[model samples]
Target: MSISLSIHGAAHTVTGSCYLLQSGRTRFLIDCGMFQGSKTLKALNYGDFPFKPEEIDFVLLTHAHIDHSGLIPKLVKHGFAGPIYATHGTIDLLSCMLPDSAHIQEMEVSQLNRRNVRRGRPEVTPIYTVQDAESALRAFSPVTYDEWIEPAEGVRARFWNAGHILGSASIEIELTTGLDSPRLMRLLFSGDIGPEVTSFHPVPESPQGLDYVICESTYGARERPQMTLASRRDLLAAEANDALKDNGVLIIPSFAVERTQELLSDLLALAKERRIPRAPIFLDSPLAIRATEVFMDHADELEDGEAFRHAMRSPLLRTTESAQESRMIERIDGSHIIVAASGMCDAGRIRHHLKNHLWRANATVLMVGYQAEGSLGRILQNGTRAVRIQGDEVKVRARIRTLDIFSGHADGTALTQWIEDRGPVSRGIILVHGEEEGLTALHDRLAKKGLDGDRIFAPELDAVFDLLAESPSKRERPAPRRLQPEVVGQLDWHNDLSRLWLDIEEELEKAADDKARRVVLRRIRRALENERS
Candidate 1:
């Protein structure tokens, strides 16, 4: 019997990575990630799994990024009980990140319910709770890199450092039939491969001898400009000098994982060399601080392990763990740098920081990571004059800047080089976790390398291709009804209108007299009437 693979998620987008593999009686999954990006994409998170969760044997998690591992709690909550295998570094990071993800879900649900209660709408529970996340954690089985193990019957797998994050890895699986059969298959999954190298980690080694390859093309259409560690420090110093010109707050909205730690190292290096002033630096996200500790625990996996450990203890750095402490940061006077989480500014304490300082001309929000399409960070990056945060309209007067040196994913050129180094594949390549443009560009490059057009497959959402078949055939199955993008957009607009109406209601309630209330209500009515007309 031949092993068959199904492309479940991350086929035409950059998030929600999941794949189903089947071999005779055994079935397994890889990367049960949460969908992210525009509201249309995020709705996929609440949809049913393509395959029954309870039927899968186990999950092979690539890394701990929410885009890659956020749905583990939801998976476990849906009745999955098998082991979730990952690298040692990934396991430690998950220990902190999963609970934080659960907390965010609970808080979001609570906030929504508060509004629902006032609006007479039914309250909705979170997709998964903290207990669910904790339960998922119990199923994790940590394995070191370069070691092979049998996660399921008749299958062997190994993890190779992807250099994307602290414990990120590219997985290799070898499947064989019965002892009497001579057929065997080797499959490789590139789980968000990192760049050539970062300040914290060395370049990832390419895996060889692959029968088939499932790869990511997140940055496949463009190449990153060359930047060295020294240049990266210089760029940070320049941004700091510009932002701190008049004792201003320099806010860096970073991801809680590798990005935050990398920024800390660069900032500390700059301060130590006197290239930048020794400003008060606050690590504001509780999740990021916890992940930083995990980085410390696995310092040996980093490039300059000793330097990373020392930088975490720098006098210029302080961590804010509690809500009270986070609020206390606003009381801090003078030039200071605050690094917070939810890099996209979609959630977390970064919104609080943005709300407080975004209106100040002297403040600056330095973006050091990729911001998804509908994220607040992207809106700011696009130079929006105003944004609604926590139902309050916040002006955007703060200086906004971005430095690409901090990105963990490889560029198009780097990805091409890595693929070239990985040698030839006997079967074919399936490109996932990228947009259409990137996928097309990468596919063209692969075609030039002798891969035929028919062999390079880029499936759409829910589209499946059987790997073990004689030729690629679109699976014929009953398609489930999914909300159309237009419908999703309409729903999003409704939510926005509801929030605006609530803001108006609150304003009217605060009015001092009947006349004032009448004026506010009239304005709201007029605005709605004008919109209709």
Candidate 2:
């Protein structure tokens, strides 16, 4: 009659959001997200799941964002045959997203293996393949928002509009226990709550008064100014106007899903209104193009459906589907905009565009989404003078700008309000999907609002808890973790090695003569020899 919850991913970090819930003989997962960010974190993607995939009864997906649903294909590949329940919109998005994610992995691993061959290292395989992703698709069972369904014995669940993205939802789960008495345990998983004022969808809504609630805190520590859609577009127009004023190219590193669609709609609307000069805005990622089509197909469900459809169909919006066409964009001249994927600039065509344009002083890189710690986008935002891109060092002469107004997640204030609105939580609040600062800030804010500090639980990765207990109690881990919890969100040695290389080059360039450079090299060699000794 007891239930347990395990934090498999997204404990003290913003990506890789998975949770394990077990009640009696029934077992299921809330999400099977892929790990993103630091190498130490991403390494988990290639490792075995903490629990047996075959033992899992089913999965409840929050949305189609890679960080929330990317690893489902891997789960299926690993023998998980259970159905993955998601909203219709989420299913549609994943039909394209999962395959695209697999393709990226295959492509990246192929290139990595080529380099490994050159260096005599063992080749590595991708975590999953396109075929595996398609297989995962076949397992999806779509549910409509606000509808309740039973996926297992003693478990009935409902999906509510999260307002985060197309078909995004906050899941409400009811577990019935004590067969004779029929006691019910209620829980709500707030899957990435969206902001109040957004271009699409109304404010995030959910049922109030629950036994327990697990929430996301991606923007828990940061509060942004409240902006209407018009004001938000005005800001974008200003940035675009300034970036293109000197006939400069504007490169936007965008997420291929909701983020890209939102930007495309606004950009086209601005152009149509003559707020910003009309220029060919190239959608460079094939994944993004496909997602845009999904958005168009589901426009009737959105807030400004007609406007969005109009914006999406604009002639100024050009989609480059072929690799040749993508490469050809580099040969173009003048003040056009390039919207490419891998929003954090960690992968995808955005890196290629960055390598080609980052050295140009007139080019501008506009970041319109969250950039995790140690991501290339964050590094650029930190004002690094140079960065290595695809084995080539590129000077960062281009203007780097961030517009936080476009974030899908609610800000600190909005998140706090959302949590408050889901009030009268009888058991406790479990915070996940955030870094240390965010988790702490949200915890403190909740405390200030008169909630008991002890009731707010911020569990680390792989930490298990007894959900039926009077208070959240941690359980001993069954096995050692792939990486220490301390190493999850912070920069790892891989990042350090990159920085070390950059530093050495900087020092060598600063040397007055060859003799001085030789002296520096000799000192480094001596240090290495000492370490070996």
Candidate 3:
């Protein structure tokens, strides 16, 4: 029997990157991420898991980003009693991230409950808890890069640095069945590549001898501008200098994991140089500070050969106690620059700051990360004159600026450039993690670059693709399939309708747990061919 891979999540859109893989009687999950951005995507976070959590043999994590690892505690809560695997850095980060995420979910749910009191709507409980987070972490087994481990029967796993963040990796898999005609399944899951080769870390080397490729195309439609390390520093300094005119607050909405550390390191260097005025710069967001400490613990991943040396010279300001955070907020009333988490201005202390400063026009709101659709950061980035927070619509007077060069995600041109360097790994490539616009844009470009739609496909979330044994003597290259926008428009009414064409090969009994899953997977695969054509 042939092994299979499913587009469990991050198929069409960038968030909630879960992929289900199977070989023989074994099953496992990869990157149990959460859905973010617009309501449409958020709806996915509340839906069923599709497969029985207890039945999954194990879980493998790519990194600790909320989108890639936020749902682990929830999975554990839902009966996934198996062990989880990740890198040492990922484990440390997740140790902090899981509890933080659980706290947020609980707080958000509580807030919703309060609102429900008036509306009389049903209350929604949080997906997990602090205890759940702690419970999930107990199963984590940290492995370093390039180490081979068996995740499931016939499946061999290895990790390679993706350079996206500290401990982020691209997963490599090899599987061999115990049969006379044993087949080798070699697959690479490009777990969200980083933007550049930084002084803090090395770039991801292209893998060799890959048979199938599952790549991410988050910024799949745009060209990434070349930016030097010094240029990024200069850009932020200029922004700070401009904001320091009145000695007002400089609010940078950072991702709290990688970007926050990078900013903290940069600011520490500037403070030493006395480049900008040294008003008390506060590092709020308990999660960000804790996550930064995790970075320090795993400082081996930090770049530039002297991160340890630099730490010795100028240590970080990572606060822990509640009073420390309060102190940071209180100092903001004076001439101070405050760096907080939730980079997209979605929630946390950053939102409180925005509530206070949105109408002041004295403060500066600087964004240094990607702002997904429907996020407060995007609303401000779009030049919205006014915005709402919590309940009040605050007038926009604060200076709004976004510096994209500091973003961790690789843009469209970079992703294509990386794919171009592939040395015959596999002709068939599937692009994941992007909006429909981004995916469609990338699909057309890849086609022009000689990877026609038949050779390279961008799948929709929950979409499925079938692999058949390749002919040894006569292999035909697949032709580009024309986009059926009209058909796609019709699909607005009903989804995955192509299952009507199922034949005897539509074996649902052979799939996980039920005949329905078999039918659903089969139809989802058929829908892909029609949706593209």
TM-score, per-candidate, Cα-based: 0.90, 0.98, 0.84
Put down candidate 3 lDDT per residue, 1-533, tens digits, no spaces. 64556676776667779888777787888899987665445655676776778888898889999999988888888888888989988999988888988888888889989999889899887778889998999989988899899866688899988888888998988878545887776778889888874546677755776677788887788676678877877777888888877767788888888888788777776766777666666677889878877776667657763563464245335443464554447544556777887887876778878887878867899988877766678778888766667766677899998877776777877777677666465647778887677788777877777764676776655654444346312222232222222222112211122223222224543466767776777787798889999
Give stretches of model 1 more than 4 Å off. Answer: 177-181, 472-533
Worst 10 residues of 1 by lDDT: 482-491
For residue 98, model 1's alpha carbon misses the true position, in angstroms, by: 0.5
Clashing residue pairs in candidate 1 are 200-303
Best-first order by TM-score: 2, 1, 3
Please, what is the whole-model Cα lDDT of each candidate in the order they appear?
0.83, 0.91, 0.74
User: Model 3 off-target regions past 4 Å?
Assistant: 177-180, 305-324, 327-334, 469-533
Candidate 2, residues 1-533: lDDT per residue as tens digits?
A: 77888899898989999999999899999989988888878999999999999999999999999999999999999999999999999999999999999999999999999999999999999999999999999999999989899999889999999999999999999998655677898999999998877888898899999988999989999989879988999999999999988788999999998889889888998999899989899999999999988988999999978888888878998999999999999888778999999999999999999999999999999999999987899889989999999998888999999999889999888888888988999889999999999999999999999988888988888888787676444432443565778898888898889888898999999999999999999999999999999
| Better structure of 2 and 3 per TM-score | 2
Candidate 3: count the clashes.
2
Descending-lDDT candidate ranking: 2, 1, 3
